[model samples]
Target: MPAATRHLARRFGASQIALNTKMTIETIYIARHVDIYASSAGYRMNWVTDDWQSVTGLPRDPPLAEYGLSQAQELADYFLSLPEEERPTIMLSSPYYRCLQTAVPTAQKLGLPLYVEHGLSEWYSPVAPGTGLHPRPASAAELRTYFPEIDESWQSIYYPSRKGEDVEQVHDRANGFLRALIPYIEHKFGGKHKRVLLVSHAATVIALTHELIGDRNLPLRVGCCTLTELQRKPGETELIGAWERKRLADGSHLKDGATREWGLEDIIVINDTGLPGTENAADSPVGLQVDLLPPEVLAHV
Candidate 1:
């Protein structure tokens, strides 16, 4: 019944996003950004916030670590190895350096358009500085300078406050984001562009799964750079279930078994300009900033 209503809306023009006339999306990939953990304290990882600030000389948004970049490249390699129709038609990222960076390799390899989405940003926390559960994002201008491929006029739909949004709020936001975005994808590029890739944070990705699977806080765990697949066929009301959960794909291309874990003692101090404590903690600027494109991608760019 619910699936029927969704299809009816797609068939007719009753929804805000008009359908793409003849398109049907076979798969959707929602992923968490590659690793950003640089140093850890008690309960949280510092997100290596200052490392990117020093590198770009921009605002304080955490960038990908050396390992993280390789993970993204691996992901690009995975996608590139896939059949043409399987690649993402459009790519989107959270309004964070890590997520944006994760998208860079694939976006470049595929020559796909990348958009920054505010709703996809990491969970916010107004809690004190010491806690590791929250994130502070870079401004749009700063991000634009680094990632010129992003549409210039794009604005964030999710606005964060000093005290970050809680679990329920994030869950609700993820639900709303998918509800609006799925229809838009079907309407905008139904036939030609059916696959959509979203690079986001851990909590946000989990929330999205909750919304799609109709479960609250499902125990699904997403590793860094993990890819989760969901399918919405033509007349299905809540995404085909039973077999759907059984079919969810996570981190299939990832060859690395264990992710990098950091401790405070391993941290380095790059310089005064670097984040206060994380001086040389992550890879040098040479590695972090450079994108060593694969041979095939060089032809396009």
Candidate 2:
């Protein structure tokens, strides 16, 4: 280990050093944003009503519901209960209000600087007719006003298209972030054994999981405040090692487990499969949701 790494290990403790030496593992924890006050028809309006657009002045970006706030607190308590060595060393969140709101408590508890990463921003779809363009998310500087812990010094790895991103574009954005982020972490933190927590939307969580595991066929479960863990051992070359899905979208910490869960079918449609009452839907290839990136794209990581 380098001098900086040795210092970090010593600061953390001897046990952490031993653990790092034994496994040399790095971890990424991807968390989906908690539920928001949505405007869906027939859904109960707790904080906002049907005219939520005129009420909040934010049609697309809604704040977390009352229940979601409690869930965020629970998440923080869960992190506090973990051993120091197992806790996250760095935290990143999407610029969206919901994601930032979900991450704030944990960031405060961990004493980790919250960095706004556009690469991990919510998946953007094309504008619908008569619906106008989707409102752009708050910038890092703007987010700082609400989240004082936000570290504005760090630059984002990638930014999504202004118009919107298709499914493949979203997948590519996630891949690009992974490729750039690993090297940046190695350089900034000066160690292989690092734990990073990313708070983002359901689509982004699924996309990030796909990129990390290098598998698009797996059925991903994304729920409000759910955590999906990705892990990899240190490699000989400069390239980061291939990643494995250590944990699916797990929301065991929450008192009410896995609320407002979203699946592959929610984001992508495949021959009307995976729909309710579809024949043999459980075994259908709808599980093969996202298309794998090109071989060259995977090689860069």
lDDT of 1 by residue, 73-102 (tens): 889998899999778878888877778888
Q: After superposition, how far is residue 33 of candidate 1 from its true place, in Å?
A: 0.8
lDDT of 1 at 235: 61
TM-score of 1: 0.66
User: Given candidate 2, what's the lDDT at residue 101?
Assistant: 83
TM-score of each: 0.66, 0.73
Cα lDDT of model 2 overall?
A: 0.67
Model 2 lDDT tens row, 213-284: 777666887878888887774552333336777788998987777767787667652221112232222222
Stretches of candidate 2 off by over 4 Å are 1-25, 36-48, 51-59, 128-133, 234-241, 268-301
Tell me which residue pairs clash in candidate 2.
none
Q: In model 1, how large is the Cα lDDT of residue 229?
A: 77
* Per-candidate count of clashing residue pairs (backbone under 3 Å): 13, 0
Q: Best-fitting candidate, measured by lDDT? A: 2
| Model 2 worst lDDT window (10 residues) | 281-290
